[model samples]
Structures are given as structure tokens and as C-alpha cells.
Target: MQSANLQKQKLELIEKIIHTDDQNTLDFLKSILNDETSDYELTDEQKQIVEEATAKYYSGEEPSFTWDEVKNNIRKRNFQD
Candidate 1:
């Protein structure tokens, strides 16, 4: 396809996404948002943290937390004075 045609198609799709209230459309958008690449563009400090976590993971010395524990920690953090 030509570049202009592809751009036009992309714009139409984006307009549909913006205007539609359908459940499936919302779910599809959610899946796109949940993609790892779609999440925050990591800062240098965040990149370092991820690298350290990966090394610890490979070393078998990493700490593990359950989803509930993580959620609880987040809740506590949000409520902190």
C-alpha cells in the first residue's frame, strides 16, 4: 500500500476507536495499552532498576512478592502521610 493510503487508514481507525463505545473495541484498546512496549518509556533510573532486577532474577537470589502483597504495598504507599 502507498504511504498516503496507509496514513489515511490509520487516521480512520483512530477516529473509530475514539468514537466507538463498543465493549470489544474497548477491550482491544485495553490489550494495546497493556502491551509492555506501550507502558511508560523508562527513565535512566528505571532502566537501571530493571537491569538490576534482571541480574538478580538470573542469579536466583531475587526476592518474590505475591500480587496481593504488591497491591497492599501500593495501597499503603498511597495512604502514607
Candidate 2:
């Protein structure tokens, strides 16, 4: 109930902000909105890394762990401290 009220307040404030003629405020808001929805494009190096990893996985050259093994490993590490 409290969260709903907060969300409503935020929407009202954003609606007010969207109508302002202030350039600086508008630019700041544009940046915030852009950051929220920005799609990150992978660089050539990053693409190459991903492709190599995929190849290794498909070739079974990369080691894989089952869920049970992972849980056991985590339990062991937690008790080691």
C-alpha cells in the first residue's frame, strides 16, 4: 500500500517534470531515461571472446558442473572459513 502511494507520487512528479521548458532539467531527464533503456553493443573483442567461449563449450573443452556439485562446492566453501 505504501509502495503504491510512492509509485503514484513518482509518476505525478515525472509527469510534471516532462512538461517543463527548462533545457537543463530536460537534458538531465533525457540522460536518466536514456541510461534506463540503453542497449549496450558488444565490441569486436567482446564478440570474439564470446564466440571462443561458445566454441569451447560446444567442443566440451570447457568444464561444466551439475547443480548438485555446485551446491556441494558452495557448502564446502562456506564451512572452510
TM-score, every prediction = 0.34, 0.43
Number of residue pairs clashing in candidate 2, backbone atoms closer than 3 angstroms, sequence gap of 3 or more or interchain? 0
Model 2, CA-based lDDT: 0.89
State the C-alpha lDDT per candidate.
Answer: 0.86, 0.89
Q: Tell me the lDDT of model 2 at 24.
A: 77
Model 1, span 14-56: residue lDDT tens: 8998899899778867888886344448899999999999999
Candidate whose lDDT is highest? 2
Clashing pairs in 1: none
The digit string of per-residue lDDT tens for model 2 on 1-81 reads 579889999999889997898997887788887876645699999999999999998999998889999999999999998
Worst 10 residues of 1 by lDDT: 31-40
* Ten residues in sequence with the least summed lDDT for candidate 2: 31-40
Residue 26 local lDDT, model 2: 82
